[model samples]
Target chain A: MDSIYIHIILLALIIISSIFAVSYARVIRGAIILGIVSMLVSISLFLLSCPLAGIFELSVCSGLITVIFISVISLTLPPDEKQRKVNSVSMMKKMVLLVLLVLVCGFSLYMLDSKNITFVPLMQNVQESIDTRDNIWNLRHVDLIGQALILLTGLFAVVVLFKKDKNKDKK
Target chain B: MSVENILLFKLYIIATPVLFLVGIYAIMTTRNIIATIIGIEIMTKGVTLLLASCGYFNGRPEMAQSFIIIMIVVEVVILTISAGLIFNIVKKHDSLDTRNIRNLKG
Candidate 1:
């Protein structure tokens, strides 16, 4: 028997909504909806015994979503200049591209369906230096902290870069 | 719904890459920066789903869950910073479409 059915449903809901949210999200409200979906999914993961992921997901997805949504939404709300050219070709191109993409994705999904979908649980992507499977909990903390710091630094650099470029544009 | 089967967790590993790839394709082809960020999020989310499923399959939760947590952090940060930059670019250049931003035509 499965450990939790409702969580699975919630995850499924999150995944499906995420895909739709991506496709249909034109404005800020739609994006917020998708971000909300991510938050709910994170909560579900926590309920399934993954508190670490749950906490970050809530922080990123929920914590930043409201402000980000409002800001992004407000940024493009009213065009100050009537510089919009209204290109019709771009819309047609996007529609055609979307159809082709759907076809390809459908075919790929079909192909994967016929095969044995489950892998051998060989832990393919995991780094193998930590050989002991049973005792990984205590071991990963140090590495996680280091990688996390590096990641934070990288994010800071990116923001500074963006700020620099925007200032350059102003000049 | 078929994911309810006992073997579905196992299958999630295979499905994960496809989801990630498709999401990337969406991101690359779409010109909208927001859509692109959403695409990147999808790809990362697929990886998390894959890792979580793998852990569930093998009955190991610690490592996978931890990575998922890290990914969530990075995703949020990247999404905000990039989105903010794109918004700034759009405002300054007067175009939400990214293709038109290249003013250096050398």
Candidate 2:
């Protein structure tokens, strides 16, 4: 019973923080709110019996991603104040409508008969105590290789994108 | 499954789609490029929740956790590359507005 309540609270926090994340006028504030959303998600993952994923999310999404966003925001110039004010007013109006839509959707889904829905049957022959580490290192080695290759590609991309072009500088 | 598990699953079903909607609306309504990326991140979060819940209910938490870990790695790489792109875009345009990039001459 308490677990259900905790999940509900976490869901509400995720939704509210996500709303604020997109609605904030300042990008920095939005980035910070996004971090909060990620944190809540990590907690929810933990509750859902996914401690490893939760740890990764907490460290990568909530910590690394937020820092990356902040650094990007710092590198760029701020938007014009007058333009931002105009945009914010219109955005607020849209946000109100969005909130209404979400409420309606939530109510309708709540009233839904989920019992009618079918899901995959639990695999009885599978090992009940398999470790996530073993699953990743042994069962999902291809994904690990893919991750490494993609990381290398991303590193090269960043280096090329940020490198100063000497010819352009001379021109 | 227990009553509590079913309730948790229901909560995930309802909340995941709501998060996706918010993300889509953000991407649609915002003109800033960074905000678009943020919207994408939000949508990814929804997907993560869905995957986690599905794994939990399916008795395959290990599989789901591995997938999520791989997903996080891919997401980080994508984000880093996008950040680099945004950096260059800002350097050339002097603004973060997506409208400025409408004219693409290869």
Candidate 3:
């Protein structure tokens, strides 16, 4: 019971931080807030008994992603102050409606009766001996290959996109 | 099966969509290209949570963990590519506002 409450609180924090993340005017601040959301998510994952996922979420999403966002933000020119204010004002108006809709949906979901819905029974014969590492390396080797392929593709794409064109420079 | 498990499941089910909505709203409402990416990241986080919770409830935490690890790797690569694109966009337009690049020029 206590743990459920903690989960609820963690989720609430996640939502709130996410809201702040999008609503902030400064892009860097929004990135930082997104990091907070990721951190909360990792905590929730831990509570859900998935420590490996939690650790990955913590390191990758909260740490690496935030760093990526900050570096991108630094590379981009900041918007003019006047335009930022205008954008924020309009965003706030839309955000209010969004919040109201989200609240109603949350309430309805809360009121929903779980007994009416049937969930798959937990697996009774899960192999305890096969750990996550072994599962990834053995059973899910295809996904590993795909990840490696995508990463290589992304690396080449980034290099090409960021490379300066000498002909365009001369022109 | 357990009451705690059911409650946790319900919580995740509710939270996931809300995160999705927030992310979509951010994507649709923001003029900044980077904000769009941020929104996408939020949605990704929601998906991660859903996957983790489902893994826990389905009694396959190891499988879920492996999926998440792969997901994280993919997400980082995607983010890096997008960042590179945004850097180039900023160079071309000199501003982060999407309004400045509304017209696609050949």
Candidate 4:
């Protein structure tokens, strides 16, 4: 019961941070806010009983992705030139749409009658009682192989691209 | 299913869609390509949340976790390549605003 409340609060924080991230005028600021959103959402995922995913999200999304974005933004534009032109009318329209969607979600949740909602003990109900480690090693081994392949591809691509850029610079 | 689980599930249900919309809004409203990439990242997170939540609901957290792991790897790769492309575009066009790059128009 207490934990559920914590989950709700975290979820709310996630939504708020994302909204701020998207709406902020400065691109770097938006990127930073989006990083905050990822951190909050990862915490929320932990509260919802997905600890592994939450930890990965925190490390990868919040940490690596945010750093990548900040570095890219800084590399491309000077700190003094932080402001980027935005379409105000479209921004307003999107905000309005987002507000409406949020309202509808709240209204629907209200109408759904929380008292009737039910849940099962997800971990306990599993007949196999397989450990998460086993699940990864035994059941999803193929994904692990794929993960290695993609990471190598990414590293190679980054190296090749940066190499090309360096050659261009010298020329 | 416990009450806590359902509550969490419902919360995710409400939140993920909003995240998706906000991501799209971010992409559409921002003139800078980098900002649009930020929006794409947000949308990817939302989808990951949805996927993990559904897996948790079905008592298959490992399945979701495994897939999300793969997803994160792929996402970073995509973002890296795209950032390079964006940098190249800036060099060629001198601007990150999508409107200024009209060379693609037929």
Q: Estimate each model's TM-score.
A: 0.71, 0.89, 0.88, 0.79
Cα lDDT computed for each candidate against the true fold: 0.62, 0.86, 0.84, 0.75
Q: Which structure among the candidates has the greatest lDDT?
A: 2
Candidate 4: tens digits of C-alpha lDDT, residues A90-136: 65676786677668767776775555545434555343646667777
Off by over 4 Å in 3: A85-115, A121-129
Which residue pairs collide, candidate 2?
none
Candidate 3 lDDT over A120-141, as tens digits, reads 4565645764799888888779
For candidate 1, lDDT tens digit of each residue in A29-68? Answer: 5577667776766766565456666676677776675467
TM-score of chain A of 3: 0.80
Q: How far is each candidate from the true structure, as Cα RMSD in Å?
A: 5.1, 2.8, 2.9, 4.2
Q: What interface RMSD, in Å and to 1 decimal, does model 2 have?
A: 2.1
The TM-score of the first chain in every model comes to 0.60, 0.80, 0.80, 0.71
TM-score of chain A of 2: 0.80
Point out the worst 10-residue segment of candidate 4 chain B by lDDT: B94-103
DockQ of 4: 0.48
Greater lDDT among 3 and 4 belongs to 3
Can you rank all candidates by lDDT, best first?
A: 2, 3, 4, 1
> Which TM-score values does chain B get in all models?
0.80, 0.94, 0.92, 0.90
